[model samples]
Target: MAEQGKAAEGRIRIGIGGWTFPPWRGRFYPAGLAQAKELAYAAGQLTAIEINGTYYGSQKPESFQRWHDETPDGFVFTLKGPRFTTNRRVLAEAGPSIERFVTGGITRLGAKLGPINWQFMPTKSFEPEDFAAFLSLLPRDCDGITLRHAVEVRHPSFACPEFVALARRHGVAVITAGDSPYPQIADPTAPFAYLRIMGTTEMAGGYDAAAIARWAARARDLAEGRVPEDLACAGVPQPPGPPRDVFLFVIGGFKEANPAAARALIAACA
Candidate 1:
């Protein structure tokens, strides 16, 4: 399916953070042969997709199939485990539900599945001892398949060095994220790297080509060879402004920054 993906020079993956549209069936869009063609059209520019919506609930197989068929090959799909499993506040004890959610998400996507993002909420105080132990229990096999795993921790404790050590030990990627409230994840060394960029960040979220260029410059530096070793921990930063082709994930949220980011990415990549 990726065979049809238009190859653009200075290409960089650009996409929205998660599904926000209510309608799924092919009503809003035409190009997408599946549920949401508009989303698909947006996804066309992105080489990878981080499905944050799935983290909230389970998606039907039909929905998953539709998404898989609409996209081209070489496209990476990063899914977030349900919040019940990921959010360690009241739902931390919900182990059975967690397993079910993870299994369902992974199985539904099948080959399209990439890393399952386990993003923790900011409420829970970071407790590495319990947290790390719980994370260790994640089955290496999901629905009889082994997949890449990445964790995005919101608690401050996650920023410490110990968290990095634990993430590296496991085959999970240490997500690099830039946010407005606080910068949670960092650029660490691992087999895989998960990155998150907020379009609202005062420091990074401006519709300025210079800002996008700066972010792209950083991404190009990190994307250099030796990605496998860094995959576990290494990931490029998110390009500023609208979703751009300069970085792996040019996330454009509800902001004018999306197009701005896109412009900057095009310039830097050019």
Candidate 2:
């Protein structure tokens, strides 16, 4: 997939939400392809994948190890944080669940582990103190491996300067969710940037050529630590810093065409 590695400015990884889909059997996957070989085949086509299964329940250590062994080098997987940890009344009390998730054999992924996405419910509003406490519960490292965390806040209350400041203080990224009802916070809060774009089904490749070109340019701007002027920012503009790694995933809308959209973005980035 266009030589998965650091670009001229910074590393850019493009992928889809998950690898397993029934519709993809004959469309994305070849006809009569074995189910066991799906991950391997998908990994060969994309640089990264966001694992949504981890959000539902805890997985066995062997499962994580097997996934690691199946994928090739330079491939990475981003896990969705368990719902029990994020879907709570008092976020501060989620420490125990958070601890369980972080220590639940995730380190088995080794170098293949990307960021852990802690997605909050749309009904959850931004309580500065409680949100800060929730961020504090996230560990910086686990089993000698440095961990990266990203929060996907769907509520409109998160579109504020205070929220951005809080995230920046903890060095946790705020996911840029595109083409969804969720508020799109494009501020750069962490060392790396995370984006999830949902392209329309009307277009053959999820998005038109011009739209893909615009997203590719935005991805490059994020990688080089320069916020794109076209995107909305809640906080005051900051000076450009060093290059940062970027993770972009094509999700939702026109699910079957997501892989093609990701591949197109990868080629554009190259």
Candidate 3:
């Protein structure tokens, strides 16, 4: 009940991309931990996880239920929207794909389900009308569960104020991608903030202590509805609102050190 109360009031969640990395075995995972216990172990350590496999293919309903049963209460899973839905010529024509993916029994995760990230190719340019149409296709609810959507646009074309305005108009969060070549958009457009931080291999725990401290501060600012002045904002500044939930994933950098980074961030936030 305490966990549910914290979740309801909005809290910061730090986690890694996925739990199935071979490198994590004997490093993040115990030396002789069974493969079947990986998810449970990861869940115990991290507050959330971004499931990258769903971006490639669909999973059975039992898989979702199993994931929910394996994890503790308040653990969240964010899924990547399928490539078939986002890697298309016409964004507006992706209704069927979106519907299929959303209705594919993901509700089995119940309260454990978090945001659904729709990542676009770097080559995909921003088309305001088409993009707005695509945002409209994202349903507000699925099987009585409220759904939150976040967009990960990698192209430089999406760095414009118009794009931010469009996302804000539809109440979809723009992902803040760190330590990558992708254009980072830090505008807070929704009720929550989503960040994917990729730290370097040179630093221990995927990030130096100073960097982790900075990220912790930034996460707290976002969680409290105060945008950090250090980050770039493409849209005009808006007044701070009520505190919002934050989901931060340590991904794409030193893969082996991601768990350590996430743990460090969690400690810093604490």
| Candidate 3 structure, TM-score to reference | 0.96
Model 3: per-residue Cα lDDT at residue 26: 90
> Any runs in candidate 3 off by more than 4 Å, and if so which?
1-9
Using lDDT, rank the candidates from best to worst: 2, 3, 1
Tens-digit lDDT track for model 1 on 1-270? Answer: 131112422234444455445432232234345444555664565456677778777888677777777776655577778877766554336568667866664566666666677777776666766766666767677667776667766656566666666676775666666433544554444444455666533234344555565655555544442222222232343232221122245453434344335434544554
Reference-based lDDT, each prediction: 0.55, 0.91, 0.91
Q: lDDT: which is higher, 1 or 3?
A: 3
Which ten-residue region of model 2 has the weakest summed lDDT? 1-10
> Which residue segments of model 1 deviate by more than 4 Å?
1-12, 19-35, 90-94, 200-206, 225-253, 256-270
- Candidate 3 per-residue lDDT over residues 115-140, each given as its tens digit: 99999999999999999999999999
TM-score of each: 0.72, 0.97, 0.96
Greater lDDT among 1 and 2 belongs to: 2
